[model samples]
Target: MSASETTSRRQVGWGIVLMLGASVCYALMGVSVKIAGRDLPLLTLLLGRSAMLVVASFLLLKFRGSPARPGNPRLILGRSATGFVAMGFYYYAITQIPLANAVTLQFMSPLFVAFFSAKLLGERVGTTLLLCIVLAGIGATLVVAPDLSTFGGDSLFALAAAVLAGVAYVMVRELRKTDTPETIVFNFAVFSLVFSSPAVFLLDRVPTPVEFAALVGTGLFAFGGQILMTYSYRLLEVAFASVFSYSTVLFSALFGFVALGEQPTLLAALGAALIVGTGVIVSVAERVPPAP
Candidate 1:
């Protein structure tokens, strides 16, 4: 009835659409990683990704006239270090496991965030939060059931990526108080590039044109997804917008099926549902106001 209400609804609509687009971009990025990894070493792929991110993030900071240096160097470096290692684990998982399975396991970040936030941020974790964490743990186990018998499986890498990603996110929460997102991203990109550049000397062969394109696509799609997801949060509440992020799991499954001819087993499908459902509950619960 009111103009404000009408505008609010429209913004939410746009936010959902943008978030869905972001999910698709992320899924495509995973597919691209799989394609590129087939021909290149993991370190080579990381080098290419870091280079693209450095270029893209540098240009974005310049366009926004943001500072290149971080306000809190120690925290920024910690976040960047964790993020870089997590990315390496995630990329390795993508090459070794099914795309959907890898994405599902990595999505466990939010559950790990709960644990880290309680310990590091002094945030209280209630009964529901604890229960959600247990459910998510079980869900993750189911997703990786097939590989559990193998020591040091790729699924473990995905789970490790999730844990480190959670730590990086918690650090980002602290960094948000002092630095802009653009500055944080630029710093991380630079950190990744500087640390990963050594891989260039280790490369055994140059990538073919098709492999090169896939490597480039990995960064382009990931950056696009990050930009779109960030803007969507501006339009919608973080809790509501985050639900749309689970769509990335669905998109990854679809892309894996179509692009890579991969399919999820029945148990993995059930596990993915549990993880996505618990993730949505945890995200929404965190945003709810405490009872009076």
Candidate 2:
């Protein structure tokens, strides 16, 4: 093998490592959100998380010598808006439902992403993609079915989060044409902070020391995960990196079981398998060249 091929393999190996670390960070973030949400209001949690992100994003931009302003304000705002709303629903779902269930449901964003890209981006939806979507739908239904009896509309909140996340991701794909990742993240942080600030004033409650730590952990973990995942994609193909992204669901399941004593029912576990497995198939399939 050529030296270049050896270097390429090394890069891919490191990328996988970074992606796995990001997944763990994200799973821990979910765990922190679950813990903090037990004592804090959703808005309050959002406010705290957004506030930290704003500060962190600003520092990152400064460190990178990048401008804080977005190159395309319209797309930035759209992505941020959708992401903010999706985050709200996701956090709420984490509090109301099992951590793995909420994570798996939100992980359905890829299925929705495929649909939205075809509709909004004028991308083609091939037969393989359609099959993956159908299987993912069944998986999501199974995950939601078990939660419905106890959590009521909470499970739907996760699904809403997934839908909005799909829109936000599509917007991000478009925004990448003009904006730097730092700029996009900085804009999102500022947007989330400005919009979620109302929660701080509206919900006047003091957090205990434990809750405060958990709130801080939520932002820290999320920021770390975002940065790691972004860097991983820089080293590897998006499709390849995204397959490891599904590892977040597994980490969430393990963390949920260990930290929260939350165990998925047999059906939910099966659903998670379907979603994760179908997601892997879709990611790999998207990257494969069509046979002539």
Candidate 3:
């Protein structure tokens, strides 16, 4: 292979690894949310998580000597606004639905990313890539099997979260053109903290010691996941990188089972299998240069 092609393959390889690492962190964050959701108000949980990110991102930028300001303030603000709202919907859905189900629903963001990346970023969406998206979508649907009566309002919130997340991911790709990952993350955390602060007064109960740990864990894990995801998306084509996001659904299923004592139905298990299988295919296929 040519040198550029070889470098592209390597980037794709590391992107897949980083995206999977992100999935693990995100899944763990969900576990923390599940544990703390009982006592924490939606806004309150967000407040703690955002606050943690603010501190973590600041330290990271300072340690690296990276600029804290985003290169494109407009794009950063738009990204943060969409992400903040998506998170609100996500927290509400997670509280109301099974953790795995809520995550699977939000997994729809990859489909949105694929389309938006193609339309907005002008990224290549060849036949193979489109098939990967379709396969992943099928897997996600099987995992969630969402129905009107069963999921109700939570389903609506989940869908809204997915749409908003889609927009946010597109903004990430856009920002990557001119901004460092730390800048994007720090700005997002700043916006989240500002937007979520007003909801702190809605706290239902003060958290116990264990609950406090869970709250902190949510922020820590989420920050790690966001950092990994930012780098992964920056390194790979948005469409290709997004296909690996299906890994989050698999991890969410595993965490939901162990932490929440939720058993996956046979169909859901099959769905998870489909998700993992497609992820492998996409990862391997991406290494090969597209026929010119």
Question: Whose lDDT is greatest here?
Answer: 3
lDDT of 3 by residue, 163-211 (tens): 8999899899889878888999999999999988986678656789988
Cα lDDT listed for each candidate:
0.75, 0.76, 0.85
Q: For model 2, how does the per-residue alpha-carbon lDDT over 92-160 read when each residue is reduced to its tens digit?
A: 999998777788778777667777766886656677657766776676557546555565578899889
| True-structure RMSD for candidate 1 | 4.4
Quick one: best TM-score, which candidate?
3
Evaluate model 1: give its lDDT.
0.75
Quote the lDDT for 157 in model 1: 96
lDDT score, candidate 1, position 182: 82
Q: Candidate 3, overall lDDT? A: 0.85
Models ranked on TM-score: 3, 2, 1
Q: Tell me the TM-score of model 2.
A: 0.80
After aligning candidate 2 to the native by TM-score, how far in Å is the CA of 200 from where it should be? 2.7
Residue 71 displacement in candidate 2 (angstroms) = 1.0
Better of 1 and 2 by TM-score: 2
